[model samples]
Target: MAWIILLIVGFVGGTVGSIAGLGGGIVIVPSLLFLETSLGVISNMGPQIIVGTSYLVLIATGLSSTIAYMKQKKVDFNSGFIFFIGSGPGAIVGALINRFFETDQFAGVFGLLMIGISLLMFFTKSIKPIGIIKTGKLHTYTDENGMSWEYKYSTILAIIICFFIGILSGLFGIGGGSLLVPIMLLLFGFPTAVAIPTSMFIVFLSGITGSVTHVSLGNVHWLYALALIPGAWFGARFGAYLNRKLNEKVVVTIFRLILIIIGFRMVINAIIG
Candidate 1:
């Protein structure tokens, strides 16, 4: 029954993730916790296991999705590499921090954090690009590959943002897509399609780094994570198709609502527990 529930969660999380450009951590963690709680299956350690397992499953989804997007010319490899160059170190730091918390405490804090981020994503309106300079206009440039580049801010600013996002990813075992995608689109002015693939690319390494860290601490549930990947992959493909068919605003609205609900549930559970 738990395996069956995981498959359902995987489908829901993957579909929503594909559409929203998040790796689905926002939904995955809460859903697992809720399921574990309802079943009364060692609730104390369930949250940590959920985090570890989600990242493990994400490794599969991220690799598959990244390859698919790269083949379609959706990913900007140079840009992704640059962003992740700084993020790699940050992830390690975040993982170290994660290891310090007790299971129940981590779960509560993690749940509340998800809820806050979700609310922010839902309510926040337009956040304009940060300029290359404090006073400069947002500029778009074409690269040698004919890919469009918008460096609203300086390279330094971009690096800073990536570093912070990476830290968050490591700490929470999230893919950082939920946070990175919006910032990339709204702040860097990257196109939605580009942002989606880039988010996947970024999440790949972050997920691996976090997963490795969790594994070292004996927090991962390998079999459980493996069980959900097939369903997640299929759901991702379907969700990607749906993403192309929907309007951007409508997609975002629905995605935000899903985030809010998941976030709220996590917060509520945290409080109760």
Candidate 2:
């Protein structure tokens, strides 16, 4: 029965995450806590274990979505490469440090981070594409392999953003796709299509790094993670397709509303705890 609830959570999370460009942690963790309490699978280690196991699930789901995006040429490898260069190493370091903390503390920290991200979503207004792409002074370049590229300040910002994202990924067992996609779209000026693919690429690296860390720290629950994979994979693909059909403004509005709810929940939980 608890497992069934996890599947439902994964299904819903995959769909919401696909539309919002998140890795699904914000949805998954809260759902797990609620399910665990309802189902009486009480364990002091539940939160940390859930987080660790979720990253393993993220790898499978994220990998499939990445392939979907790559085949469509929606991935921006140039930015991905730069972000990877920074995040990969940072995640390794963060994962190693995670072994020192207890689950309750980790949950508190995760909630705080979510609250910050949610507030940022509420306050941030317009996203401009002008400077992030080639204008009169900027020009697109083509590599020998025939792939086209545009250089922008957003690429530099991506590297900086990944540094912090790496720490969050390691600490929370998340792929960091939640933070990566929005930053890619808003800060880097990537289109929705391009941001989705690039965010997936970032998730691929970050999830693997965090998963390895959790495994080494003996925090992972392999069986549980495996159980959630099938639902998340199929749901992710379906969600990705739906995202393409929505209007940008409508999508942004809905996304912000979800963040607000999640954020408020986190803050309230923090205060109560």
Count of clashing residue pairs in every prediction: 2, 0
What are the models' TM-scores? 0.85, 0.82
In candidate 1, which residue pairs get closer than 3 Å at backbone N, Cα or C atoms, i.e. clash?
Answer: 131-152, 132-152
Clashing pairs in 2: none
| lDDT (Cα, tens digit) per residue for candidate 1, span 148-230 | 76544456677788888877777776778878886776667776677887788777777787788778877777767766777
Write model 2 residue lDDT over 1-273, tens digit each, in one string.
656766777776666666555766667776665556445653444655777777777776667677766766677777777888778777777777776765456656776777666656544345454454343223244543576655355455557779888877766766677777666556555555667767777777777877887787776766666667777777677667776677756765776666667656655665576
lDDT of 1 at 181: 81
What range of 10 consecutive residues in model 2 has the weakest lDDT sum? 130-139
Q: By TM-score, how accurate is candidate 2?
A: 0.82
- Provide the global lDDT of candidate 2 against the true structure: 0.67
